[model samples]
Target: MPNRIEYYNFVNGGYFWHHASGETYPLGILVDQGDVLSDRQPHGKPAGTLIIYKDGNVAVKELLSIKSEKNVWFAISGCTILPKINMTAAGFTGVYSDIGRTTLRPVIGYRKKDKKIIIAVRPSSSITRAQITLKNLGCDFGITLDAGGSTALQVKGKKLHNTTRRLNNVITW
Candidate 1:
């Protein structure tokens, strides 16, 4: 069956996740009651502590509690991912949930489940449209995190890959 949530092994590549409390719903921007971030916008990751799984192990890396990049961490699950060819949406960043600011949150991170890495991020230009597309593709549900410049995928604990400026939200592959 097709589902929006996925699991992974951090071996091939890690994935990202977006969470928000019971905010932005029906419109359903936030998934379940958990931490969330706008990857498309470079504002930040989840507001709470985020655990990073590395190299297909149970070890978790806690993202430092800071206001800068040091606090930023990646999403690693019991899944593996193959190198993905980024389509677009790069060099963008944004503040958390502030529409007045000119920024972007990119979907950086992957989950390896069912032989695929599910990336998470905010919709680049049009969130509504992006959600529509994902729903059409069987996403059904998704959380809107930071997009634009903030959207970045990190692999191997401290390495970043994939960045562009085409579709700020949603995983291309």
Candidate 2:
């Protein structure tokens, strides 16, 4: 998590939360000011979502589709929580996987209705439940960042969730 001085540097600060996790470096492709910080190759298929910040706007895109680096002020990746799937009247049953065991999740969500980006921390939940929560929150798409002991969230300088593990990436505003 960022300290007081570091958090103050953000132009439009509102929410501050841990974004990604690693020991010595970030796990995904981290971009700052159009500079590629870490291009760590993914192990299997691109299952991450790229959270991008550009022109004072935030966009969440699939890791595989983001090919261009133009105007990318800052970028980070997180595990895909809500994959592209047809939402029928029943529910998102097809995407309910038991892979992600119950745990705290830091999420980034995108509402297609207004093209708004949301940064929130979900309570101890599975990936399926987290996806459902975001879907209920009107998020069309979302991703889960490093969770468990690395999960952290702060709103308006007040610590909501703080972890002992060191954080590698954080998103402000």
Candidate 3:
């Protein structure tokens, strides 16, 4: 039985040796089956990292707050688009800007009633709009994935949005 889904993008920005050819390395951590494939700590606090375990458990935690565990399978790190605290409390203000700006938005959230993870790609919306949409959809907690031109969402070999720019990382279920 599969407990959760996994997605991969390029990498989070961080300390790295720049290539003369203009190729940049991923600075964040990527763990597979308890084996670390890439492990470069991010330079600053990002939104957070989504951790998925072998038992079908999922969590969105603060940057650098999580320690490696035996049952942990993998994780995705990105700038904290939305924090868990705001999701639970519903007090969204000053945490985000560009409310009027619209772009492709990718989001991950947990629906407590359904006890399932919700993955969505909003065709065009701002962070504020995304928050309102997620709240209305009954998400108890959520976080924004990479958005703007880097946004990409695919299901069953079908592309949800046509993104020309190559993404550094992605999350899938």
Model 2 has an lDDT value of 0.59
* Candidate 2, 7-70: lDDT as tens digits: 6212221112344553345656677677776655243234455555666666656453345546
State TM-scores per candidate.
0.27, 0.70, 0.67
- Candidate 1 residue lDDT tens string, 1-173: 22121222121112233336422211111111223333222222222212332333211122222233322333321111112111122112243224212333322232323322234433343444434433444432232334444355444444243444222123222
Cα lDDT tens digits for candidate 3, 1-173: 23112333222121223357755455555566666556544443333556678887777665443454447787655434443333212222344333225887777777778778777778678767777767877886676665676665657765566555434445544
> Which pairs of residues have clashing backbones in candidate 2?
none
lDDT of all predictions, in order shown? 0.28, 0.59, 0.55
Global CA lDDT of candidate 1, please? Answer: 0.28
Q: What is the lDDT of residue 151 in candidate 3?
A: 63
Query: Deviation in angstroms for 99 in model 1?
Result: 4.8
Q: Which 10-residue window of candidate 2 scores lowest in summed lDDT?
A: 8-17
| Best candidate (score: lDDT) | 2
**Model 2, runs deviating above 4 Å:** 1-5, 8-23, 53-60, 64-69, 84-99
Best-to-worst lDDT order: 2, 3, 1
